[model samples]
Target: MRAAKSAYPLTWRIMDALEAFAAFVWPARFGRAIPWLMLAPALLLVGLLVLGLWLIGDASLRTLDTSTFLMSETYTLANYRRAFTESLFAVVAWRSLAGSLMVTAATLILAFPYAYVMVRTSSPVIRKLLLIALFLPFFIGQVVRAYGWLIILGNQGMVNEALSLVGIAPIRLLYNYWAVLFGLVQYMLPFAVLMLAPALTAIPEELEAAAGSLGADWLRTFRHVVLPLARPGLVGAGLVVLTLSLTDFAMPAILGGGSQDFIANAIYDQFFRTSDQGLGSTLALLLVATGSLLVGLVFTLFGAGTLAMGRARQ
Candidate 1:
């Protein structure tokens, strides 16, 4: 009985010591609120997105009965089949893909040199002015910008007038592939510059200086040092531009001018013009799928580029 009483007191004292230490190290009550506060917004956003997607999917499954404009009943795959078998959808998809690729490539080619100069130059005034100029177009609405392009590219517009002054007949520039390409590049160029500028700035100056000292010229340094470091930014920017160009309805709708159409425009036409909700849903889903795939590919490339860069540095 005496031994048992002694052991109980010792065990209780150890437990009290552990409890005091834990309380001193970390206050259990205070930390609970922080995680909950941080998690609330994320949970709310996820719930809303899931709810919205579910509603869209539900609406997509139902078909409109022509007898009554409001009457929609039955689920069918006919809409999906129509989307695939129909030349209109296929043509639009192909055009969107091709146009997006061209626009992305063009933006990269144009923005890279500009971005490099902006990052490497020691002139603050020039850099600030150029940065402001790059972002100025975004201050204007896309529709307004599109209309401005219309004025510039139209037959009776400034470009044609200039050509006429030079003794050349007004060439067809508006409402064509070139016009669309021009508009897309103009819109996407700023994004490319913004992405590339940061990446370029992140590159250490010593790398370039060392390369020069070792007999590597500017082009060689850029190829060996700058290009590899900038790969992630390039891939990210390209993906963003490509996706924007692919889904962009306003540019194609305005500049394409019945000559061309993208998947987004096709979706718009189905929903509003033809009253084909099912088909439109399928097309929308396809657009989402394509965007997801493009994003996945970009991240994969980015990961590989990052890993390769790390290995090269080692």
Candidate 2:
């Protein structure tokens, strides 16, 4: 019995010694570095993006020679000039900017109520139903959703068939700017709701109740109390929706019928259709700048509405 007890203690001692040796060898002693370690993947991603941007920036300074189907070996500002001066580029850029803004606004408006209800609702069944509804689209994928819209909105599809039953002629729903916007709004709704849900969840319900107790109506309580607290989520969600909408290619491609093109569509046409890497790179860099500017503006204006969710208390 004494020998067995001694063996157990000796085994524990050996395990402890191995652990100490491993810790010493690895030397991950810096508690401060844990945060940096957590951020390593993000930092790596950003670094790759920076490298890609640098390459694009270099490419943007060159012009494509249509005759030779080759880029100019020497640098030039012709691509940038063309981006601003060309009517096609201008129209596409304007459409993308306008669509992104509109989609962001619409998504936020729709998502807020949905997120609020999802967070505040007492019934498990309703919450589950809402979650299922939101998540169902995720499995279907963006391309599929866009295609689903195509099927539903096609001349002979369900929507047109339903309209024909009412004695109305089949309306052209797909292959237009409005169709692209509708698809974008539908696609972005779930993302916005997901972002807003956590922010809504963070707000204490007691604050709303207290406001009501202090002679505030439901509307006033929402406007004054809940809205202010939910700003972080709203800002985060809006930024995500805005950036995504601005860069979206598929919806515009499928729904726009090649006429109502967004910036991404234009970029694709420049790169793939025309094989003009110089112009594509220029447009890509410009998009990055535009998106960065928007994010900078938001961060500058509202310091309260940070992207970080439940940041470390320290």
Relative to the true structure, how large is the alpha-carbon lDDT of every model? 0.84, 0.91
Evaluate residue 185 in candidate 1 and report its C-alpha lDDT on the 0 to 100 scale.
96
Clashes of each: 0, 0
Across 139-239, the per-residue lDDT of candidate 2 in tens digits comes to 98899999999899999989999999999999999999999999999999999999999889999999999999999999999999999888988888999
Which stretches in model 1 have alpha-carbon errors above 4 Å? 1-30, 304-314
Residues 62-123, candidate 1, lDDT per residue (tens digit)? 67677776526677777777878999888889999899999999999999998999998899
Top model number, TM-score: 2
Worst 10 residues of 1 by lDDT: 304-313
Task: Please estimate how well model 1 matches the true structure, expressed as its whole-model Cα lDDT.
Answer: 0.84
Best by lDDT: 2
Cα miss at 121, model 1 (Å)? Answer: 0.6
TM-score of structure candidate 1 = 0.85
